[model samples]
Target chain A: GPKVLQIPSHQIIDMGQMVTLNCDPVSNHLYFYWYKQILGQQMEFLVNFYNGKVMEKSKLFKDQFSVERPDGSYFTLKIQPTALEDSAVYFCASTGGSSYEQYFGPGTRLTVL
Target chain B: QQQVRQSPQSLTVWEGETAILNCSYEDSTFDYFPWYHQFPGESPALLIAIRPVSNKKEDGRFTIFFNKREKKFSLHIADSQPGDSATYFCAARTEGADRLTFGKGTQLIIQP
Candidate 1:
């Protein structure tokens, strides 16, 4: 079975601070995605990355948000000048190709005060 | 547009009973549907899935019934157990796409 790993299971940060969420996707996966889920809400797609470039991004992905897969290492999502509304569970998912099945990581719970 | 919608925000059933979770989608282009289950403090895992071309797909106690014309689908859990208590999400993706649009979710409780 394939697995995706996310670091810093839970994080707490003050408003206006910077936070970086890390994800280690499945070894052979070619596509990476980021999703956000608020309390008692649906999981929303934030962005998808492939071949070192962003393929698509939702409107919720703001200017403060950025993603990168530097040197074929961990895929990172950085949010600078975080706002209170940024508090939520950020999930990382990966798939071998463009398919319906996407393996998800445990998720990084971010709390902004 | 909200692509996927699920009914009955929550459900409670006795062990060994059958639990049915309903889902509907508005995107006609959606050809793939998957149901994901999530326990508290854990990420969602795929339970079962079906393609629009098929009317039903079953794997053990989990079953997915898809109606292509109506754009509706449902998940049926047979012989439910307390361990099956969790949140289930209905997701859809169009062909040749990797992004999945998920429904709000249904919290199912299988009481012992």
Candidate 2:
């Protein structure tokens, strides 16, 4: 079965610090996505990446957020100067193609104090 | 706009009973509907999916009933077991769309 792997299952950071979340998608997948879910809220799309470029992004994806798939290795999301409101569960997903289903990772829980 | 909505925030049923989860969507362009199940501390897994062109799709005890005209769909779990307890999310996506819109979610508990 195809699986997506996320590093640092849980992270706690102080306000104004930087944090980077990493994801290793299925080897054959071509599309990668990031979603965020606040406690008791619906999951919201953050951004999508394909072919080393950002395909689409939602308003929730702020200027402090950046994603990269450098060297075909880890796909990472970095946030600079994290805010308290940034606390949530971040999920990474990948799909083989447009029509294929997206496979999700266990998620990284970020708690900002 | 909330593209997708699900009813019954939570449900509890006996192991041998049938659990019906309801979902509705507002986007007419949504062509793909999928149900995802997630256990505590785990990522969501794809349980079943259906296309708008089909009225129903079944795989084992999991079934998806879609209504293209009404923009509604539901997931039916037959012969439910304790292992089936989890939070289920209804999601909608369209062709060429890079992201999926998910409903709030429904927590189902199957008691043995």
Candidate 3:
């Protein structure tokens, strides 16, 4: 049972502010992903990163959003000048080579006011 | 557009009853289907998964029935218990795809 850890279980920030969500993916996992879930809605894929580069991104990944692992450290998702609609629980997931299973973190609940 | 869809937004099943959750996808190229269940305060954990190469996958009381021709699949929980109450999400991804398309999840309630 691999575990992914996310910092800041909950965050409340004013609109137009910048927020960074940190995720410590499973130790050996190489692929990282970020997903956004509005309350009672489906989880939407925002982006996926591998080898320090973005592999794919969805429309939901706005221009204000960015992601970086920073020299094999914690994978971080940053949103600058956040909008009210950006308020949602963000889950980080990771998996190793050739494995179809992606283990998800506890999720960081970002609330924009 | 939703690539993955699950039926019955909410369901309540009595103990010992079988609960069936349906899911379908719009993409025919999707080769992997996985079901994840989340408890009240926990992250979604992989419950069971299946590939198009098989029509059925069984793991203890949980089973996945896949229909590649119809682009549909379903999860069956037999002899349900109260602990089985959780939100179940059906997801799909194509081969070599890194992102997963998830359904709007089915909230399952096991009535004792």
Instruction: Give me the displacement of residue A14 in model 2, in angstroms.
Output: 0.8
Name the best candidate (by lDDT).
Answer: 3
| Structural similarity to truth (TM-score) of each candidate | 0.96, 0.97, 0.98
lDDT of 1 at B73: 98
Q: List candidate 3 stretches off by more than 4 Å.
A: none
Measured against the true chain A, the candidates' chain A TM-scores are: 0.98, 0.97, 0.98
- Judged by TM-score, which candidate is best? 3
With a 3 Å backbone cut-off (N, CA, C), the pairs that clash in candidate 1 are none
True contacts kept of 1: 0.69
- Clash numbers, per candidate: 0, 0, 0
Summarize candidate 1's per-residue lDDT along B9-81 as a digit string, tens digits: 9999999999999999888888789999999878789898898879999999999988888889999999999
Model 1 per-residue lDDT tens digits across residues A64-112? 9999999999999999989999999999999988455899998999999
Q: Estimate the lDDT of model 1.
A: 0.93
lDDT of each: 0.93, 0.93, 0.95
Q: Candidate 2: how many backbone clashes?
A: 0
lDDT of 3 by residue, B13-69 (tens): 999999999999978889899999999778899999999999999999999999988
Top-down lDDT ranking: 3, 2, 1
lDDT of 3 by residue, A45-97 (tens): 99999999999999999999999999999999999989999999999999996
* Tens-place lDDT digits, model 2, residues A19-98: 99999999999899999999998888999999999999999999999999999999999999899999999999999884
Off by over 4 Å in 2: none
